[model samples]
Target: MSDWPPHPEAAAVPSLSDLLERYATLRDTILSLENEKNELGELIKAALLRGERAETELYRSSVRVQKRLEYPLERFREVFGDAAALEAASIDRKKAEALARAGDLDPERLREIALVKEIQALVLTPKGS
Candidate 1:
């Protein structure tokens, strides 16, 4: 990110203190810019609702309504009966994993259905010679 004109300290290897200061500056700048962007986005959404259609030389904005259905389980089951409520049921991953690990279920099938995900960040890499 410091690559455009190249930061002054980049001329030589930056000390850890210099890197920490630069990191804080960039982080704060990003947060400020994001806040500004979110405020503008809310304005554009409101304009779209008023049928004013916010547009710029480079971009045009349109609004779409996204919806989700949530039901209170006991009340819903009383109204719709058990079969309809069956559609809303989900497997408990931890219990399923326990069974699979014990060889009572196919681990591969569990993996497919569970769709577990991991979050990772790039911390370091070996330099190429």
Candidate 2:
């Protein structure tokens, strides 16, 4: 209503220091919330185990209970046989890295075998406190 376009100088620009501070504050808040969420999740699991019903009102909430069977590596191999164990075993990256560094394996081949993804991250260091 007032002006169709605002002046460049009139526009507010956030400084790097301000942005870094905000990022750090947000990271800390997210970590705190995650911890709270994990604690609440455990409580909910307990409630579900105790036969608490899922509610659907202003906020729809449900608890899913699942039973999982975990087998010991050595015992599992003994019970299911070595062929079954070999089939279930995942590729070990550390061993592969060692092999590559020792010149026993090609680095390019190793990279090809593993899922490679490039990520850019912002690193902030605080001034002397």
- Per TM-score, the best of the predicted structures is 1
lDDT of 1: 0.56
As a whole number from 0 to 100, the lDDT of residue 46 in candidate 2 is 67
lDDT of 2 by residue, 1-129 (tens): 633234567676667887787779879999999999878767765665577754433343455434322334465446445664465464345554565577755667555445543332212223331
Output the number of the lDDT-best candidate.
1
* Total backbone collisions for each predicted model: 0, 0
Model 1 superposed RMSD (Cα) = 13.6
| Weakest ten-residue segment in model 1 by summed lDDT | 120-129
Pairs that clash in candidate 2: none
Task: Write down the worst ten-residue block by lDDT for model 2.
Answer: 120-129
lDDT, candidate 2, at 105: 56
